[model samples]
Target: MLRTLFSLVISAAVLAGAYVYTFGVPGSVAAYFGPQQAADSSAGAAPSGRGGGGQFGGRGGGRSTTVVLSPIEIQPYQDVLRAIGTATALRSTNVMAEVSGEVTAVNLEANQMVAAGDILIELEARNEALNLEIAEAELAYARETVARYEQLQTNGNSTVTGVALSEARLALSLAEAKAGLARVSLDNRTIRAPIAGRLGLSSMDVGDSLANGSLIVTIDNAEALIVEFELPERAIGILQPQQVVRAMTPTFVGRVFEGRVTSFDSRVDPVTRSVTVRARIENPDGLLWSGMTFSVELSQASAPLAMVASTAITWSQSGASIWIDNDGAALAVPVTILYRQDESVWLEVDLPEGTLVVTEGAQKLRDGAPITSADAPRGRNSAGDAAAPNARRDTAPRAGAPT
Candidate 1:
């Protein structure tokens, strides 16, 4: 009986395999088991019909990305070279004492605007005045002696050599008197401004003993400021005197100071390979000061070129590019940047005039991918209005289309 049971079990297994092969698993299972178990088995299998395609569907199904576009147009763009520089006074000097003496007066105030020949300081000159008086007395005595000598010579009371000697002595005394007067004038005790400018802080005050060449004050002609900067030696070919320049400083943001290139170094620095350039800027309001840092920009002549918003340019492993909207499809166009300004970038590309280029939402695009214009009206695609119910129902059969 056990042998018979084992043979029967083997036969049953073979029959089950034959049934599965002939009618398929679900059909064979329905034939063997009740319909309820077959239904459960079918439910556990991969979904069928409308729901078979899962979340995003198989390959080749993605929603079109929305983007904003701007048309490429020709614009006049100026090529600019930028550099950092320092603002300096047009003329600056250290006011020093020509002769040493006690400081008797301070005639200048800190930050005072002075004119040329204006007295800035004074020193005691009483001794020089006394010396001048003594020399004048000596000169007067010499003239009297010369007159007496001539009278004696005319009256034959003295020899001609003696009279000639007296005349020579008198001439020497007159020269000494003139020298004394000049010395007194030289020691006039007043220090005057050599140039018209604004004065810095005075180094010596009243009663301060000053030595010769001691610094009295500093003066700067700030009305016309100079901005000095360095540029590559190659720029020497383009640089010229009286070229326009614009400069900006942190102290005056958004305010551009206009200037002209006044001079450049005769030789380029061997170590830096750069040449020094100086530009003269007007400072009528005296807003600019010496030693202040500035951002200098020198621009060449303007040229017509294709310009786009800087945001529109994108970079990838393939270098710089931009997305062009070609009939509701994104086309990546390679570009070469020629120049960049604050908000615009000039590019050299093969795109035609008025070609629409994506500015916003560009990163979500790929080559030949369908795109929807962000600037389109609400609930509308790039083509036109929203699709009708029948059209959406028709598209449902396609992969990735929402049911």
Candidate 2:
């Protein structure tokens, strides 16, 4: 019987330890549960508040949540389309040799400005000149022989057949002489610039024997530069010739080049679903070069729209929306986004002008939940920046305050 009594005491000690661990000491447990039961009884007996719900009780009698608000306004908006393009010379060509010969003289230097038909290279032509002279002498002898034969036939000293034969020989010699002249002309062998522009590096040097059709140099007309870019097929109807465009390149930072739309492709690319567009920019100082990439911006002015801070917009399963203050209660209003800039977004919504929209602390709000603006004095919210106090209203219920 004594051993059984000792076992009962040990069991009682184990139960006391578990109770202390789970609920703290008995006095501490009473301290924790005492206030909570009294607070619940008080909140149930109180009248409904604007916040509409208690922190842990049924709807109503809760403290208002604080949020930052911004007033809705109308602002001028412009739609802009951005794209990348390549800059090219208005006119460019690869100058080539028309005839083959040894380069006896190089008349042009690299990066030289030249006019059309300016001689660039000359080839040797002494042998061609000699052949031309010999052909001319033979033609002269034939002409004299034909004249003599005609005169003899008139004086009855030569037969008609003899005069005819002499005439035929003269014709044959004339043909040979004309052929020699053409050969001599080809041997003149001078390569001239086809168009006026700046020249690139010469491909052949003095004494270099070049074949026909070989590259001589490249020339580009830089009076005007062309930028070619692609635009979506949907933009075909909106684009027009002579529309203003702005372009920028990495090579020329902080400088924008203005241009006008010059032309567009007639057919849209099936693979990309885009159309090629060309714009012309004047380059009088030759600052822009061919094959450089440029960032292009095209803008179109439009009517004013409602504008708000981009941070005010929030997305959910329903769609994009923003929280607005209605009689000191949080109300979510859906909006359709129209355009967006760096700091602001233009939207299409039916909200009245001067409506206060929440820009911060929106996550703690529910429909019809009481709210206090961070701009308010007694309800200051640390999560949001303070704004004009006149913009905030004190319409929500507060803790430990009259109804």
TM-score of each: 0.59, 0.64
lDDT of 2 by residue, 1-403 (tens): 9999999999999987654433223333335654444343333332223333323233223446667889999877876778899988999999877778888989778878899999989898777677777777776777776777777778887466765866767686786767678575765587788898889887678999989888889999888999999988777767889999999999989999999999999999999999999999999988888889999988877667888999899999999999998766678999999888898999999886788998987766678666777677753322233321222334555566798
Tens-digit lDDT track for model 1 on 1-403? 9999999999999986664433224433356864544444433333221111111232113234567889998987866778999988999999877788888888878888999999888888887777777777777777777777778778887465675866667686776768677576655688899999998987678999989888888999999889999988778877989999999999988999899999999999999999999999999889899989999999775567888999899999989999987765677899999888898899998777789988987776677665567788754545564521111222123345566
Top of the candidates by TM-score:
2
| Candidate 2 TM-score, C-alpha based | 0.64
Candidate 1 Cα misplacement greater than 4 A, ranges: 1-70, 138-188, 232-238, 308-337, 340-352, 355-403
Total clashing pairs for each candidate: 0, 2
Off by over 4 Å in 2: 1-50, 53-65, 76-81, 130-188, 231-238, 267-274, 314-318, 326-332, 340-343, 351-354, 363-371, 379-403
| Model 1's TM-score against the true structure | 0.59
lDDT score, candidate 1, position 153 = 75
Clashing pairs in 1: none
Global lDDT of each model? 0.75, 0.76
**Which whole-number lDDT from 0 to 100 does residue 221 have in model 1?**
94
